[model samples]
Target: MSRDAASRPARERLLDAAGELFYESGIAATGVDAVLARARVSPATLYAHFSGKDGLVAANLERRFRQWRDVWDEVLDERTDPVDRLLSVFDAVVRYRAVEGNRRGCAFLAAAVELPPGHPGRQWLAADSRLLTERLHDLAEAAGAGDPTGIADGLLALYDGALARLARQAATPGLDTGDPLHRARRMAADWLAGRVPPGRPSG
Candidate 1:
């Protein structure tokens, strides 16, 4: 089928359904049949677009990356101050988390853990992480951080740690859960204000 004429709507519908189901329920637990049923498409139509469940999963991951990039671009556009722009990334994360029914942790990390290191999805995750890290580095440089790469690494670490903590807290009740994004924002702002030392370069 041609790219333009292919069952694009069905494909997108499948991707949307997969993202919702896979994130809410574990990817391993969601089957292709369920995805097709949710998308209201037959197995034949789905197969024409994707190789199988794996292909669908990869497509869903790519869709998420696109969504994230779009949001990041919008946030960056809203802030002219580089420091605020950099911190806006965390703000986006917090806003996303605050949305109802957002129980899934990092989708890329979840997919990577489910698949082996050499899996195609793992490869995509690695590439996506590198691109994100580079973007953060560039943003840090623009923000006048003393060491762009080191600051980028520090910010990434903080983000990953915050996400991990949030996921854990989401699982437990009455845990005195603090807002990771706010904590991260305060840390980033302090660093920007020169109150704390910039992180050392990783060897």
Candidate 2:
């Protein structure tokens, strides 16, 4: 791993640098040279620890996934009710997005759009999707929803849609929109209560 790639601190430093860049900037927009420059490591060092840019991206994603999982678990842990645990997912999302100067949207979803299906980082993105939806599924099952699967799918869709809209600053031509995240959270709550939010007509 570039001679000292086996060193714990060096590897961490490299990863930290890559993580910052990858999250703040699009993965494809960020290059190995930029990462190396930021990490203050040589090409051999990064290559030794990771195969290349894709490898670094995958590793960075793994770290991000762990961070997100921990947050999700914490948010759910604070709520005793099954329904609260499910709703807390959206709470956590909003909290993360509210962080100062952090406009970078869902890193996994962003990467999913950029990375092809065969890319190594794509696995992490797929895992992310599965973990999120599975958590919702578990919560729905605990809450005894008759259509737990459908609810889970719908909630996940709303969550991702919010992230996408937030990424683009809610900007769309010929369409007026309020805060996308606010609407998503409200809609999730309504769904949890077996109702639909106002203006979103029920079929």
Give the best candidate by TM-score.
1
lDDT of each: 0.74, 0.75
Local lDDT at 60 for model 2 = 84
TM-scores for all predictions:
0.83, 0.82
Clashing pairs in 1: none
Give the clashing pairs for model 2.
none
Candidate 1: C-alpha lDDT: 0.74
Candidate 2 regions off by >4 Å? Answer: 1-8, 98-101, 170-179, 195-203
Give a tens-digit lDDT track for model 2, residues 96-168. Answer: 6564245645778778788987988877887888898888887776776777788789888888888887767
lDDT of residue 124 for candidate 1:
67
How many clashes would you count in candidate 1?
0
